[model samples]
Target: MQRAISIDQKKIDRYGKINGDNDIIHYDDAYAKERGFRGTLLHGPHMSGFAAEMGARKYGAEWLYRGRLHTKWVGPVCPGDVFDVRIDEDGVLTASVDEQVVLVGSATLR
Candidate 1:
């Protein structure tokens, strides 16, 4: 039931590097193109954070205590790609980017 969250480049870079992902495809446009990507891609965890952020905003900070999340990055999440985060009554959360379902999972709110 939460609105979508749009992550910026700085967040992706900082978080991606923190997670030990130094793939140029994630932070270097030229290198990413060499690897066939239009630009740096968003790390998978970034999407996770986006999902969590949406959950907190919609259901409050207490909603994630006993929650669960499951998602698959079907494709690389490029910079500037805004995603929509949705939560259903059953506790399922879905993150969609450009019509593609990037993150899908469930969590329990304590």
Candidate 2:
């Protein structure tokens, strides 16, 4: 199955603070624009939620109760970017942005 997720600037700004991230790229539109993004990119944790939610849907909400979930950020998720979130049988989940791997990880939701 495929899941399409879109992240916005407000989400990015709030997530940066909530996740203890003070990176200018996450909260400064000028910085992001200078770096080529329209605005701030969402925090890794916020994007992780998309994958986690997908896992819960696939394996059942209780499945994550005792599992270890880990994700690595390989690419940035900018505002207005739409992407796919999918999982494999081995419980590995991936987030893709236009066919490029943005994040990869696995969960112990057994």
Candidate 3:
């Protein structure tokens, strides 16, 4: 399966609030730019959630009850970026933007 995941400032801020990731780099543009990022970045775990979603879509409750996910973040996701989220038939999950791979991993169920 394949889908596009769009991230925005509102979602980023909300995730930060819920997950207690109050890092200024994820919320403040100037702070992030000072750190050499294009804009306020997204929480890594929040981006990883797209993989969990793919697992759930494929494995149903088993994905939740007995799923294992391992990810490597190769790029950053910022507001207004659109990610290509997909689960290959091999069960590998990947998230990409503009030909740049942001995440790569696999979701498995027991």
Candidate 4:
């Protein structure tokens, strides 16, 4: 199954505040552009959380308590990007933006 997630500055700011991740790359467009990104980049963990949510939806409460998600951030995700989260029958999870694989991993529900 697949799900799409939208990332925006407001969501990024709120996640930053809750997680104490005040990195300029997550909110400072100028700073991020200076660092070679399109704009302020989405936090890796934030994307990972989205992947986890996909697992939860697929596996129900079992995933909530026993889900294991291992992910690698392969590309950058900017605000306003709508990315796809896909889970195959084998339980592999992948996230992509603009047809580029941004995050890849697997979700296991124990």
Candidate 5:
């Protein structure tokens, strides 16, 4: 299964506030851009939420109760970047931007 998703600065900022991560990489466009990112970056935890949610969708309560997830964000996700969260029959998940895989991992039910 696959779903298209888009994140904006407002969402990123909200997630940062919730997590108390005042990192400039997540809130300051100029600071992030100067550091070579396209813009403020999406939080790793926030991106991971998509993976978890996808797993729950596919596996229901078993995912919530017994699932373990392993993930890595290999590419930067900038505000306004459109991406996809996809899980295959094997339960391997990936988040991609512009066809480039940014996050790769798997969720296993214990």
Candidate 6:
């Protein structure tokens, strides 16, 4: 299965509020630039959640109860970046942004 996920400032802010992650880099573009990032960066956990969602969408309820997801953040996801989440027939999962891999992992329903 495959899906497209767009990262935006409103989503980031909401996630931050829910997760109590008030880091300036994830919210302030100027601050993130000063810190050497392209713009407001997405939190790692948020990306992890997207991976899990992809799994659940493909595998249904079993994924929710028995899913195992492993993800490595290889690069940053800035606001407005559209990421592609894809799962191969072998259940290998990958998430990419701008044609570049930003997250690599596997998702399986055990």
| Best TM-score among the predictions, by candidate number | 5
Give the alpha-carbon lDDT of every model. 0.73, 0.78, 0.88, 0.89, 0.89, 0.88
The candidate scoring highest on lDDT is: 5
Give the per-residue lDDT digits (tens) of candidate 2, residues 24-94: 88877788889887677778787688878777777786765766678898887887788688888888888
Higher-TM-score candidate of 1 and 6: 6
TM-scores for candidates 1 onward, in order = 0.76, 0.81, 0.94, 0.94, 0.96, 0.93
Q: What stretches of model 6 exceed 4 Å from their correct place? A: none
| Comparison by TM-score, 4 against 5, better one | 5
lDDT of 3 at 94: 91
lDDT, model 1: 0.73
For model 6, residues 49-82, the per-residue Cα lDDT tens digits are: 8888888888888987898999998989999899
Q: Cα lDDT of model 3 overall?
A: 0.88
Residues 15-108, candidate 4: write the lDDT tens digits.
9998998777898999999989988988899889988888888898898789889999999999889979898887799999989999999888
Looking at model 2, residue 24 earns an lDDT score of 82
Q: Residues 1-110, candidate 3, lDDT per residue (tens digit)?
A: 98897889999999988999898899899989888888999899987888889988988888868988888888988999997889987789999988999999998876
The better candidate by lDDT, 1 or 3, is 3
Q: Against the correct fold, how does model 5 do in TM-score?
A: 0.96
Candidate 4: which stretches are off by over 4 Å? Answer: none
Quote model 1's TM-score. 0.76
- Give the poorly placed runs of model 1, Cα more than 4 Å off: 58-64
